[model samples]
Target: MQGYKKETELLTKLLLEILPILKAQYNLEEYQSKDFRTGDIACMKSLLSRLKHLKTSKFFSTASSDEDLKLKLKVDAYEKTAKNDQKVIAILKNKEKGLEQRIRELEKANKEAVALKKSMERKDEKLREVMRYNTVLKAKLEC
Candidate 1:
């Protein structure tokens, strides 16, 4: 979960940078005031479709190849973060399994404690009866 959180954070930061470019493209399409043609809706739609796909992708998908070395470095960071996230998830899952096993063991011990308590109560009752019988026998002997 923590890994997922970190991945989400990093993706958010990347999106923050990409959003303005996407917005510029959207406005350009809406106004059609640039080199882009009229039937650019297909292109825009394709871009949006890609965006949707990238939303789920862990490798940080993008619509353009205009990425420079710096952006590529960020992409690489995203890649490393994703790999670390997988490792964290694996570790957490193992820890969860261990915790579940420990809980089961504790539950078994608790059940055993309850059974022991019940047996001890029964033994206490029998002990009281024996003491009472011994007391009466002693009185009779004194008489």
Candidate 2:
């Protein structure tokens, strides 16, 4: 009777440990709906294939080890940081493009301003010449 009791206790402990892992592995929240589309079926198949691969992978075997778990956590952290860095890079590229466009617009405006200033200078010179001619004509008339 004591032997049977010990076996039952061991079995109970094993089940307690295994049940949560199974629940996590087979989480079906996404597939709870009755309405199944073709895409959903394809996605389910893909997920099953990945699960099978994961079960056979070395990562799964090492998951129970403390050192491997710590390494996995570090890898996850680095991956998150990499994603944030990529987002920042994308934002900076957009800002650079905007600044470049603004520079081009300013350059065009500068060109137009220079051309207008040259035209005004030519008009001023022509006005001075006309005034001098008028003065000469007035002096001759007086003579």
Best by TM-score: 2
Clashing pairs in 1: none
Candidate 2 lDDT, 11-113, residue by residue in tens = 3443333333433444634432221222244544554465557656665556765445445545655676789899999999999999999999999999999
Compared with the true structure, all predictions reach lDDT values of 0.62, 0.62
Give per-residue CA lDDT, model 1, range 6-111, as digits (tens).
6545544444455444544324233221212333445545554766665565444432453552365456656767898999999999999999999999999999
RMSD each, Å: 15.0, 10.4
Global lDDT of model 2: 0.62
**Off by more than 4 A, model 2:** 1-62
List ranges where model 1 is wrong by over 4 Å.
1-66
| Model 2 clashing residue pairs (backbone) | none
TM-score of 1: 0.52
